[model samples]
Target: MKLDLTDRQNQVLQCVIDAKQQKKRPYTKGVVSRMQEKGFQITERQCAYDLSVLARTKGTGIIGMRWGGGRTLWIYDEGCIQEGAA
Candidate 1:
């Protein structure tokens, strides 16, 4: 399922996907830090909001998230295609 995502949303998602592709540890934090380094001027809260929206629009089984303690984990369907990742 494809959802219409804003440019910034796409950018943030791309960051996540890219990290995953690189087999990087702590990909989630990498996404936030990389995006900030890219000068997106986004807060972690805003980025988390975007991910939540993406998870929703990504369809019921396409994405997932879990929050416990002070950390949140995001999941992506391995088979789902990300349109804007590098």
Candidate 2:
């Protein structure tokens, strides 16, 4: 599905998708680290904010599940088409 998001948000979503595809659990820490490794200069707080916005936005297909102790599991819904991806 098509989505309206900033470049960083898009990168965050893509990171989640990559994590899922790689069979690794996509947690906020991992996601932020991955983004940083990709040279995005993202922090955990920024990642969380981007995720919250994406979850609230329509057709983005991002879901965040809190797993106690303030930890969150990020999921990229496979039901929607990933923007800029084939």
Candidate 3:
């Protein structure tokens, strides 16, 4: 998708991508903490909002699902779907 993300949103997306690449769960809290550790000021609430927006936005290739009895949220790319049918 042609993402029209703000600079901050792009950074948030990068954090999610990094976690996916590392086979780690891209939870809201985790992403926020990772960004903060890297000196990228972000809050858990804001991260959660970003994830929700990204997932709900069309053609973003980002997908978010709730697990752990709907208490846990994980974000990842819908890579295969975005690649289209072979």
lDDT of each: 0.64, 0.82, 0.74
What is the clash count for each candidate, in the order shown? Answer: 0, 1, 0
Q: Which stretches of candidate 1 lie over 4 Å from their true place?
A: 25-28, 59-62, 81-86
TM values, all candidates: 0.69, 0.83, 0.78
Quote model 1's TM-score: 0.69
Which candidate number maximizes lDDT? 2
Q: Please state the error at residue 14 of candidate 3 in Å.
A: 0.5
lDDT of 2 by residue, 1-86 (tens): 45778999999988988988898778889999999999989879999999888878867777778856778888877664455321
User: Among these predicted structures, which one has the highest TM-score?
Assistant: 2
Model 3: how far is 81 from its true place, Å? Answer: 5.9
Question: 1-86 in candidate 1: lDDT tens per residue?
Answer: 56578988888777766666776533356568979888888877788777777766643222545556555666555555454321
Instruction: Assess candidate 2 and give its lDDT.
Output: 0.82
Instruction: Please write out the lDDT profile of model 3 over residues 1-86, one tens digit for every residue.
Output: 46788887878778877888898976688889888987988878888888777776666566777756664466566663476411
Task: Itemize residue pairs with steric clashes in candidate 1.
Answer: none
